[model samples]
Target chain A: MRRFATLALALLALGAGPRSGFETMTPELQAMQRDDFANPGMLWVAEGEALFQRQGCTGCHTPAQMVGVAARYPVFDAGRDGPIDLAGRIAQCREQRQGAAPLPTESPEALALAAYVANQSRGLPLAPDPDPRLDPARRQGEALFRERRGQLNLSCAQCHDDNAGRRLAGSAIPEGHANGYPLYRLEWQGLGSLRRRLRSCMVGVRSEPFPPDAPEYLALEAYLAMRARGLVVETPAIRP
Target chain B: MRAACAALLLWAAPVLAQPAAFQVVGDTIPASLTGTPGDAARGRAIVTTRQRGLCLLCHSGPFPEEPFQGDLAPSLAGAGARLTKGQLRLRLVDGRRLNPATLMPAYYSTEGLVRVGRAWQGRTVLSAEEIEDVVAFLVTLQE
Candidate 1:
């Protein structure tokens, strides 16, 4: 742990250089993350693949076309009135392109499909589009990351930026990057979305988490993706 | 009339606990919230526990048993020799008045906070008694 912290501190000293959560995991967990057959998140990826073929998604695009698409998400779309995250874009496709019923925020199908799409981009660095219109949303996301709003009065920056690589009780505090979406969390005992992780963090600080579908979450996601530029995507990543 | 009403209310609820109004005098609160000193043993319990106080989450202290103390704040070793009891009180109550961007939570305040969880609304993170207990334990950590 000390050696890991030294490396983490070294990275921080280099000015918030992006570090994958995989780099912070214990060797045992890291091995589990590496093994697709051993990782439980692969089960969801399998389900997502089945759903992709069954739902006629192959008509317009193949699974191969989705490679690196997750990295550029939460992009500004004038037709959508603002920025749309990867999941939002997927939901929009279901409605507008597929002419299917909207996927409920309460279901597992959305998460499954997201996992499948993001899995294709695994090992690729995050590179959100540098559109001028994304500036305001990204700035708002940055502010939210730094602003103290919870009962604990701690911001995301405080723990992640100032105190990253430190121990919080028995757990290691990673840099709070969103590079690992639909990751398998040991605490949750299942695969969960990036939004679920953010809401969990908000609740951990005793703050009122934004609603499940809040636009604020997209802004935060946009900011996190920007912050994690060059860090490899680790869909179905394992975390303790 | 308001004073008479206040007197009447106090008389009506003689056992009711009133909120202690702590005065900030130059980076310190020159009085205890409970009027008497807190039990150091009880204070120590709160500081080291995982749930209560959560001091070890960000502040490493002299508790050798707790190996994974945090590194966000300065070490708690010799805290008694460094800051006065009153000074510690103010920091626990609201350190933002001193350092606006401090990561330390205002354990004894609930004012002006945004989007506090429904279960924690209108409640301070720690009660006045808990604050005094923590301060009591902190003062015992001498060089």
Candidate 2:
């Protein structure tokens, strides 16, 4: 029954179809197609590349090691015993390897850098590598995904999975993957980080958002990252 | 003796002509803004100019000359008669005091601002003098 429900939901998402009319007519859409190479976010990506170079990111994540690397992220970390999404992984690197202070969860630089790195795997299938080390984290993430909260009394799956394409307050909920983050949100008036987007979901769920770098968030990210494996990356993609 | 008499005359001559200080207390009004009426020309300038009051940052108003103002706040054209002067004072003194969710910065309340090097620090954007100026101007905005 559960499998039948899942199949039905997936079909509904694909059938509900793309946003009609003004979303295509919007200036943002026009800009995305016409000038992606020179877009502000892309420019931020270049800056991130420079930061990575200057910060010696090539040491552990060598150039060859990074090809198709983003597709495997939000993987389970044995140390964390849960899912660790790309953002969580990056935070760990900054803490353990770079010896730099944790970048602010919502800062422009962090979002831009994350988007830049993620964009490397654009159009590639998400393929999170499984390891026994990640089972605990994935379980934690799955639990959080199923938990209900907010005045709406809804779970993450209620809208993102069950009603993926259904309209809620004039906006359609997408597949709810972290793939395209840190995408730009027009509502935020700037680029938003993945953790920030996660925080937004928590608020939508009416749950008091946990702080960025929280173990629960990391675990949830890990799970979504794995689920999104085989999906293409679309960093800095625009969302309502 | 002559100087003293002149000072007394100046103090007593025209109490009615001066603008009164508008006062408010946390979403409630202990006194109405019955004091010095504001100047419309000045209030218009305050709302329109970036260096002055800059009310357009949060509130929308009919500035036919400038259309690129903030969209977060409601339009404020003809705000005077629409809102009681006391209500206006409360809104200005501290919008958060009225609606905790408002992004409208408290123009008057200044208890614990940690950031430094910003204008309107330790004070409302519009001082008592400017508040009256804006109120007086808004009162004239009625259609």
**Each model's iRMS:** 14.4, 23.1
Q: What does candidate 2's lDDT look like per residue over B35-101, in tens digits?
A: 4566768867766763456465435677788644544346787787688766776776666667654
lDDT of 1 by residue, B1-143 (tens): 11211221121111123236888899999899889888888889978874667677778888989866767678889998899999998998889888887788887888768888776777777778878998998999997
CAPRI tier of model 2: incorrect
Indicate the docking level reached by candidate 1: acceptable
Per-residue lDDT tens digits for candidate 2, residues A165-240, read 4433224456677766666665666777767766666554324667655788767777777655545666656655
Error of 1 at B39 (Å): 1.4
User: For candidate 1, what is the TM-score?
Assistant: 0.89
Number of the top DockQ candidate: 1
TM-score of each: 0.89, 0.54
Q: How close is candidate 2 to the true structure, as a TM-score?
A: 0.54
